[model samples]
Target: MLFSLITMAIVGKLLHNKGYEIEKLIPFVLIAGLVAYFIPIGAIIIWPFKVLFGIIGGILGFVGGIFGSTIGGIGGITGGVVGGIGGLIGGVLSVVFGIIGVILGIIGIAIGLAFGLVGLVLGLVFLFFIPATILFVVIKVLHSETKIAPDRR
Candidate 1:
């Protein structure tokens, strides 16, 4: 459909940068064209629905990401690495454990997310205690010094 092609072209320009491959984009456009050609009315409705849900999902994902990154950016960097490594290991383990290997891959990601959250909380608690602890020690040391070396007039 003409509508699909036009919209897809607009979306491609908006969604992707100059380096984006046309080949990869072709499938998306083709799918959109097919959906438009078959369900023209539905296409109009889908846009608003997609935009609404996308905004909601994007906001929630952003907040969750901040929480995860608070610890050591585990959610941002380590999370991807762990997921990739887990998938690779799981693939290998599949030869021996079958479906359990796939489950392990999912579990690996869950563990990484859990570790990041716990570390973030623990790190915050430690930070709070650190300055207070240092100040207490400094005050104690100064107090002890005054007694040890009395300034007699």
Candidate 2:
């Protein structure tokens, strides 16, 4: 989490230095980070599982097709239809989950940007404020020290 925040800040700072608006580029940076780091890693981790599932599903499907064929006529058609429907449902669900992931990613980026900006503003305020305040106090003390008292006589 800290690493990601630091990375985002660095990327934004670099872009800001290049005269680009960080706000507009943050999402692209985030997406690039995700694609560069996460996606390939995720795919590498998931590949074996995907292959295993595919083989298992194929074997089960073969057995199911044999069972359906033994039952003849409508049973075979029904199994095929059911498998098609299941595939359709799975496709829809993958799309829905993909969309949800995108939406959540966008929301997360927005929140991070908002917090980063707020921190930046507060930091700038305090960064100047503390020094300015010390200068004001020092000036007042010096002015008081230099001022001569009026003669009582």
Candidate 3:
């Protein structure tokens, strides 16, 4: 556990320095570590729950980081307000759709690509696009503010 935490911290810092944000990685890493630690301590019955929780935490962390970055990039109160509203909507949609799809899969109402499709949609909408949008927006804002053109070299 200690080693995991230390590793997470170091990796988090490295990612941050490489243009990734802490908010996006910390929750997922912590949840993953906790799940790993608990599997050895708990019985098999608890593993599934731990895994599910870890997934949920990762999703939430990803969305939250995107929302934060979006708000941070806009550079004013109006941007913050808009970002907050958008984040709230996005978060709700992501959670609802993700849970529904997972439930459907477990209940056998969905199969194969059908199950994966929902998950993929949920992931793309909440996980990938949100973070990429925020990162792009932030980089552009920073570039504009510093008057330093993005390096091509």
Best by the lDDT measure: 2
Question: What's the lDDT for residue 74 in model 1?
Answer: 54
Tens-digit lDDT track for model 3 on 1-153?
Answer: 765566567667776788877678778667766765665544466889989999999999999999998887766778789889999999999999999988988777557778789889998889989999999999898778567557856
Worst 10 residues of 2 by lDDT: 33-42
Worst 10 residues of 1 by lDDT: 11-20
Candidate 1 local lDDT, 10-117, one digit each (tens): 667755676568877777767766766777755677999999999999999999888866866755688889899999998788767867777898999899999999
Instruction: Pick out the ten consecutive residues of candidate 3 with the lowest summed lDDT.
Output: 36-45
C-alpha lDDT score of every prediction, in listed order: 0.79, 0.82, 0.79
Error of 1 at 53 (Å): 75
Estimate TM-scores for all models.
0.25, 0.41, 0.23
Summarize candidate 2's per-residue lDDT along 69-142 as a digit string, tens digits: 77886777898999999999999999999999999999999999999999999998899988899999888978
Candidate 1 — which residues are off by over 4 angstroms? 1-102, 143-146, 150-153
| Model 3, runs deviating above 4 Å | 1-41, 76-153
Clashing pairs in 3: none
Candidate 2 vs candidate 3: the lDDT winner is: 2
